[model samples]
Target: MNEVAVVKNQILDVEISDLINNGMGLVKINGYPIFVKNALPEEKVQIKITEVKKTYALAEVLVIYQTNPYRVTPKCKIYDQCGGCNLQHLSYKYQLMMKTNFVKEALVRIGKLDVKVNDCIGMQDCWKYRNKTQVPFGVRNNKVIAGFYKENTHEIINMDTCEIQDALADEIVNYMKFLAQKYSIPIYNETEHKGNLRHIIIRKAHVTKEYMVTLVTKEDKLKNENKIIDDLVNKFPQIKSIVQNINPQKTNTILGDKQKVLYGDEYIIDYIGDVKFAISSKSFYQVNPIQTKVLYDQVLKYAELTGNETVIDAYCGIGTIGLYLAQKAKAIYGVEIVSDAIKDAKLNAKLNNFNNAHYEVGKAEDIIKKWQKENIKADLIIVDPPRKGCDSSLLDTIKTMKIPHMIYVSCDPATLARDLNILSDTFNIIEVQPVDMFPHTSHVETVVLMSRK
Candidate 1:
């Protein structure tokens, strides 16, 4: 083991060797690595040690002796303080390359699989692509402000516009802040657990141009609720739905179980390709609908539907993917744990007039077993688990079922590799496609196709 050489506040000039998944630069001193922020690979930088640990240390870039050619000024003014976009300084071209490498590295290092990873599919226009914006409300200088929280802290960054979010969303957030101040809406304090409003969420449908606003609060009673709702509707006629989600608990979760539709319908409509969906306050739809089509197109291509195969969609949120593939398949059975999502999924299926799609609300692993007992045979199975990846039991069930073909969609590369390693014994890796769902951020979405050998 190497002895600790770097101390707190120690300054040193180092050459960055590589970039980690979080876009942090790797600097080695005496065989020990230090992670530096705002530093790029192949650049010489002077850094100050922020924190030191046994194996690794954390650093902040003090001065760049030599900067990378791809580095550019961040577009957002609050990019340094706000923690939303991590790769704004890096060029979008290199950002795609880095995300491709992120997926390739995970497959080789974590999954122990030597496979070829295709280049990441990116958007032509990445800015202002996000359809949903959720900003926390806080009291700054005795006035209400709304924006994203600082990195690893609860303090909100007061900003009127975000480059990545829809322009209309920015206008709505600023106006809502003004309305909150006028109405004297109380801002919730995590420490004291007082006040009424906690956060404001706005979701816009890119295809339909329809919008939905959800206010998260500590209580149901709001000051001048009718006036505020009326003012918002009149100000933004595109806003078809306004909802209030009540979360009286003192926790970090954003939305509560109980909700009330303040004005208009409870759900708004959105489309992915030809499939239409009714998105509610809690439904888990993809933020980037443009790249989502590209991603699902890859899934459909890999599935190679011939109108004879029965498909199963595990972790299907609102039956988006299954419904997207429902046209060419014999039947589609989708399972999700969220009851609200299941309700939306059923509603979306009906909206699209697809009677072949079936949705169930339960743990996918348990539901798969029940389906297996009922002699429900599926030709293909698709699992799009969360960042934590699929459950071990669910993987075991998939292996046991011996599904001929499988498609695994993942948002986290590390977890995707772990789950793929478990399924490698029974499935042969066919192809891995990386999609740049969230630009100017470290997150990447991947879709992998596997076949029974």
Candidate 2:
């Protein structure tokens, strides 16, 4: 086999059962349930081991011994390599079912939370629904390549078409490709690091039906970009803003310190229900707008906010959730560590005229500790920490504050469960709901509601 190393483990054939984290079908392998990244339950498959860990070893599906009746071929040509979308091969219904069960499993097994989890809020259109995408630019085979990095590696998989992104995004990539060919703008090389092009951040306004392109890099090769943008605007007609984020950092971070507008407005406004949000390339926003609306609606329902109650939104990135929940509460306090995000939150609140929503830029734990010193009370607190979950100190501070109601929005169930377990000591989890914010990917966005015991 082309000198590829092979290790044989005589794993017993077990019924394809249960999806563990990362879209793997968990089955007993030598009395231990292991995750197989590309497999679903009910499919008989052979796994090739890659790494052995203490609890679970990572493996890839080598062959499908027998395909499940539910198995459907993935529609995307680059589905396997793109890494953005998992479960792209699975049916939409199956995606919803697994995502719903994922939340239930986390709550019941880890948190010991005897809570009723509602069915996952699924999307109407599973394909090409993402509103925003960040495509990296790399050079390979003497050609500039703009696409997502391979699943876990820095190597860019040269691509012009991606099914998960809005079909227009692919078209825009193609347009950029043509523009590069005509203008001879060199593609950024990761190894050589000498190209003007670095990344492309594309966002489409749902309300205005307008698109904005944020070209991210240190140098701009598209001289007279205003004319180019005007040409693009004339052609596309729907494009509102074309901007360049001049970032030279050799990291994966999006947006640069300096931003220059090439055409039209500086920022495109996005609307979620009655509130309008101004989004920039630097601002953090949920990629899936439709599902995020559903997720926020679920949050609103669970929060049961009254105009007289005070609420605190922890880790409030750009204050979207707090802004969404602001009108219903008397006073909404948003705490964010990122100064830029806090600035965005305040701007968003002011833009939407949510006079009651106030934001402060500081770490959550520090804010909670200080607020506790002043005897600040919140009827509700929303915590949406990163995937690693909240730190123990933050959790301890949260406990110390003794907020009456807590809403935890998590992207990782394992961490969510771990945090919930600690929180369960003083709070009783009342509701658990999973929202498929990222369709196709193994990732899940879940919200847990807790009330003080």
Among all candidates shown, the one with the greatest TM-score = 1
User: Model 2 over residues 114-179: C-alpha lDDT tens digits?
Assistant: 778888887888777788867887666666678888888988887777777777777787677566
Superposed by TM-score, candidate 2 places the C-alpha of residue 378 at a distance from the truth, in angstroms, of 1.3
Cα displacement (angstroms), candidate 2, residue 430, comes to 1.1
In model 2, residue pairs whose N, Cα or C atoms come closer than 3 Å (at least 3 residues apart or on different chains), thus clashing, are 86-440, 86-441
- Give candidate 2's error at residue 406 in angstroms: 1.6
Q: Per-prediction TM-score, please?
A: 0.98, 0.91
The models' CA-based lDDT, in order, is 0.93, 0.80
Clashes of 1: 0
lDDT score of residue 228 within candidate 2: 56
**Which residues of candidate 2, in runs, are more than 4 Å off?**
1-15, 32-34, 50-56, 139-143, 220-224
Measure candidate 2: CA RMSD: 3.6
